[model samples]
Each structure stands twice: as structure tokens, then as C-alpha cells.
Target: MPIIRVTSLSEPGLEVYGSLTERQLKSFYDDLGGLFIAESPKVIKVALDAGYEPVSVLCEEKHIEGDAKDIIRRSGDIPVYIGERDLLASLTGYTLTRGVLCAMRRKPTVSIADVCRDAHRVAVINGVVDNTNIGAIFRSAAALGIDAVVVTSNSCDPLNRRSVRVSMGTVFLVPWTWSDDYQQELNALGFKTVAMALTDKSVAIDDERLKAENKLAIIMGTEGDGLPQYAIDAADYVARIPMSYNVDSLNVAAASAVAFWELRNR
Candidate 1:
């Protein structure tokens, strides 16, 4: 309802969209909770539905009555900054896709136990730092019926702007939390840890034994290095997707889709 015409890049309250680095945006209001920028009406709607509070929105003028109209309506009285496409693009360093972006407060972090509470099958996202892969994996996890997702300390933030966008906002739909000691945590929850890796003793991903497990946690590792020896060692089963045409493995995102679908509960 507070629609302001943005006339300059240095305009007050536009920092979240234009000036702040991702790290700065993350810690902008450390005590109250940090903020993240959500682009596009669709992703913003998903975050809003998930109960993330909106701080403000930056959008092109045309979108004020076009694609961004409903978002502005749903945003209540939050400040909505509108400017021409060129000015907006100059401020944000790129042309706005969908011509809208919203800065929303990050919700309080959830615990691994909370995320895994009733999950029959979960995915442990390890050190996959690529936002694109992280997002793709989350999208797959959501579609393939993975009950929840747990990310390790070193993994890319699922809420990273690019990740959130690439995920089609499925990150908001899926239950997820960060974990410092995922192996022990999953063990305590009685989950059969299945590491997606290649080892001499690794089993085929489609092995009936894996599908038979009542509760399972699939560990997906980093892009290039894959899972470390200790992580693989900690797992109850090391499994690999069968390859053909001399292909050894799939990217973490693709592999996750295969594993999630193959080992999904019946």
C-alpha cells in the first residue's frame, strides 16, 4: 500500500535489493532474523504462503499493474518501490525477470530432529555448494516423495536467491533443516543411512534391500569430490546408480532424482 516511486539507486530501503551483498542481506537484522530477497511473483507467493514476513518489494513500474499487481496486493502495506526497467536493472545489476523482487525475513532455523521427525525417507544434502544443483535436488526431492531434506553445515544455503528461484520455490514446500552431525542424528532416529557413492562394496541403488528399509536417509555429496570417506564409512549402505555407455555417475541433482524415485517407499 506504501507505493514509492524509486528515482535513484541510492534511495532508502532499496538496499536489500540493490546494495547489500548476500552475506550482508543474510545478517541484515541478525537479532530479529536475517532477510532474503525473493524474485518473481510465483516464488514470492510460495514464500509468503510458507509464512515468511515481507520486508519490502522492488519492481519495475509496468509490473506495478501487470505481473506484480497481485503480489503488491498480497503484500499488505509493505513498502513497494517502483521504477522504470532501466533504472531498476541498473540498481539490481541485472534485468528483473518477472519484473518483481521481494525481501522477506528468514524464518528461525529448524533442527534436524524436527525435520526428520516423521519422515520415512529423507535426503541429506552434503557439501554441494552449487546453488543450481541444490535447487534442482530440492525440486526433485519434493516431486519424488522424499519426506524431508537435511543439509549439512558446508552445503549451500537452500534459501540462496538463485537456489530459491531454481527450485521453483519447492524449497518452501519441503521441510528442511541444517545439521552439524547428520550421521549421528539420522542414526539416533533409526534411519538407515544410504550414501550415494561408488565404492567396491557399494550396492546397486535399485537393490531390493534398500527399498525394503522402513526408514532411510539418502546422502548426496559434493559435485566433484563426491562423499568423503568418513561419510561413506558412516553410512549403513553405500549405493550407486548403475551406469551404461561407460558413464560412471550422474550429476548430484540427476542422481538424487534417480535415487529418490528408485528407493521411494511403496
Candidate 2:
């Protein structure tokens, strides 16, 4: 087992802890096949149970024999770095709430067509950047029967630690694909492209088109400014969830839940 020392802020092993920027961490992880940092012993254990590989683990010395032990056992001879509380803080550059973190390799990506091949309904994420919302959306998607999730290139990284934690690792379970350009491909796949937007010609969310279609892709947008006009124009149907007056909308995450529940098996 590799014993990593938390001696400096710049050490590579410690860099993986928390000191790196989100993008730097994502890049390093992508090179390692999109691995993710699973914070908290609970999250780590869940990922492992789901068949994710543990590259290494860092934990407070106290948890080495307690919270960290089972993870080590399941990980099979992987390095387990034990550090004093202050040392652990120095290594991660922040105080860890759960006192344990496991770095696990990401699951492989599937093509949109592959994910949607057998799916009757799917959720298309345009540019939702809030990690929490992304996580919440994944949970709703899984619970409400979105067959797959199609994400945009410009969206927040789904593998972000907060997102993964918020999702309870559902991000790994769902089949998703990143698409810089999905318009033509979705059109070719026979999915009725539906945009969630409020516009002059936008249809109500309860419109029969959503329920009648066999293959549907519900497109949601970022929090502010809503869906871009281009995306709205690209959609075959623009839909909005009817709401009470003076309440114009819902948070993207809540909106996703509402949409997914209604669209599921509709």
C-alpha cells in the first residue's frame, strides 16, 4: 500500500485532496479517466459498493481504524493515508466535514444514441451550472424515469465532488453523454426536441405533445436568462409549466423535479 505523506501544500497527492481549482482537478481526473473525489466515508463506501475503483484514500488518523477501515478492506490493498487532524487540514487546504475522502475512477461515457436507443423519454441539460442543481436533477431524473441525461459541453462538471455527494452517486448510475452539438443528432434520432422556455409561442407543459410522443428529449436551460434563444429556436416544441401569478418560475432543480415527475410515463 502506498503511504502518502501530507507534508506540504504542493504535494501531488495532497493536491488531489482539495487545494486544486475545480478545473485543474477535473483535468487531472480526466487524464485518469475522469476519476472523482468521493468525500465522506459514506459516499466513498457507496461508490465502492456500486463497483467504482478506489485509487487512494485520505483520512484523519482517528478514522483509520473506524470509518476508513471498511473502505480499505473493500479497496483491496490500495493506499490509505492517515494524517493528524491539523495535517489533514493542511493537506486538503480546508477542514473536511466527513473526515474521509476516496478518489475513484469515473465510469465510461456512453453515446447519446446509445443511452437513448431504448429510452422513450430523456432529459437534455443545456447549461445548468449549479452543482447542487445538477446533483438534484440527476436524483430526480433517476427517480422520475428519465432514461438518460444529455449534457452540454459548457455545463458544470457532473463529477464535481459536491455534485456527486449531493447526487448520492446517482451521477455514476445514470447514463449520460456530453454534446457540444446535439441538435442535428437528436433530430436524426427521431426525438421530439422540447425546450422548457417561456416565450410567445411556447406551449403549456401539459400539452398533449409531451404525452403523445414516443421519443422525447426535454431540454432545460441555465438558471439565469433561461434557455438561449438559439436553443428555443432549435426545439420543435417550446414548453412551460403553468404557474400561479406573481410567481414566474421555480429553481432549476425544483423545476426539473416537477418536469420529470410529469413527463415520466406520461
Taken over the whole model, the C-alpha lDDT of each candidate is 0.92, 0.82
Candidate 1 per-residue C-alpha lDDT over 15-128 given as tens digits, one digit per residue, 9 for 90 to 100: 889889888888899997799888899999998898989889898888888888888888799999999989999999988878999999998888888888899999999899
**Clash pairs, model 2 backbone:** none
**Each prediction's Cα RMSD?**
0.9, 2.0
| Candidate 1, poorest ten consecutive residues by summed lDDT | 66-75
Taking the tens digit of each residue's C-alpha lDDT, what string does model 2 give over 52-147?
Answer: 888889888778778888888888877777777788887666677678888778767767788778887788889998999999999889888888
| Ten contiguous residues with the weakest lDDT in model 2 | 5-14
Per-candidate total of colliding backbone pairs: 0, 0
The TM-score obtained by model 2 is: 0.91
Candidate 2 stretches with Cα past 4 Å from truth are 2-12, 29-31
- Name the best candidate (by lDDT): 1
TM-scores of the models, in the order given: 0.98, 0.91
Candidate 1's clash total is: 0
Candidate 1 ranges with C-alpha deviation above 4 Å: none
